[model samples]
Target: MPANFTIVTLGVADLDRSARFYRDLGWEQRGDQAEGITWFRTSGSWVGLYGYDALAEDAATEPVPADELPTYRGVTLALNLASEAAVDLAFARVQEVGGTIVKPAARTDWGGYSGYFADPDGHLWEIAHNPYWTVVDGRVDIGAT
Candidate 1:
């Protein structure tokens, strides 16, 4: 069997609020889905927001108590932009939508510009513009390993 990546589901403390955050970020939600789960179509895949407890139960895993979780979850989602200005604009928009700016957009050592922000759920998202990368149809290609 071949493995294929499809959806990235975020287990959010408040599904509606998380959905709203994404919506405010200009993401359009997909209709015709179940009311219990909200789905958004991305360039190549889908992003889903579901209730944390419901997601845990669906995955057959135990939900970690809030206090037991660390401030950094050690995972980050990235959005690669076309220009440095776009990166800055994106970071600002994130802040406008109530996301915490972890780092301001600036030139990077790798000859690119990037910044970080944390969504309402503290999921880190990196907005970057890599000179060596090629973006097409909203997907990024880092070029040959």
Candidate 2:
């Protein structure tokens, strides 16, 4: 079977809060929204948010421990921009939309410009512009060799 990714879902404490955070980040919701879930369109795949307990129950698993709140250990939601200038622009837009900067945008040793931020629920996100990458028709095709 060929492998493909269709949706990226995040387990959130509050679906409406996560949805508002994404909306503040300029994402538009798609289709119908359930009581504890929200969906947004992205470049290649759709993004979704569902209440943490709800998601766990749906998967037939116990809810993760409350102490493990936010749950982002080494994971980051990354966005790739078309140009270095676009990187600056996107970072500014993120700030304007209620995201808190974890790191200022700067050139990296890997030859890219990037920065980090957190959503309202403290989920980490990275906005980056890699000189060696490209986005065509809103799809990110990695070229950083």
Best by TM-score: 1
- Worst 10-residue lDDT window, candidate 1: 65-74
Write the residue-wise lDDT of candidate 2 on 8-68 in tens digits.
Answer: 7777776777788788778879866665577899977888887778778889999756556
Lowest summed lDDT across 10 adjacent residues in model 2 is found at 64-73
Every candidate's CA RMSD:
1.7, 2.3
Most lDDT-accurate candidate: 1
Residues 1-145 of candidate 1: C-alpha lDDT, one tens digit per residue: 7677788998888877888899999998986445789998888888998878889999999999755766578888889988898888888789899999988998999899988888887778899999899888889888786
Q: What are the TM-scores, per candidate, against the unseen true structure? A: 0.91, 0.85
Candidate 2 lDDT score at position 142: 83
Off by over 4 Å in 2: 65-67, 70-72, 143-145
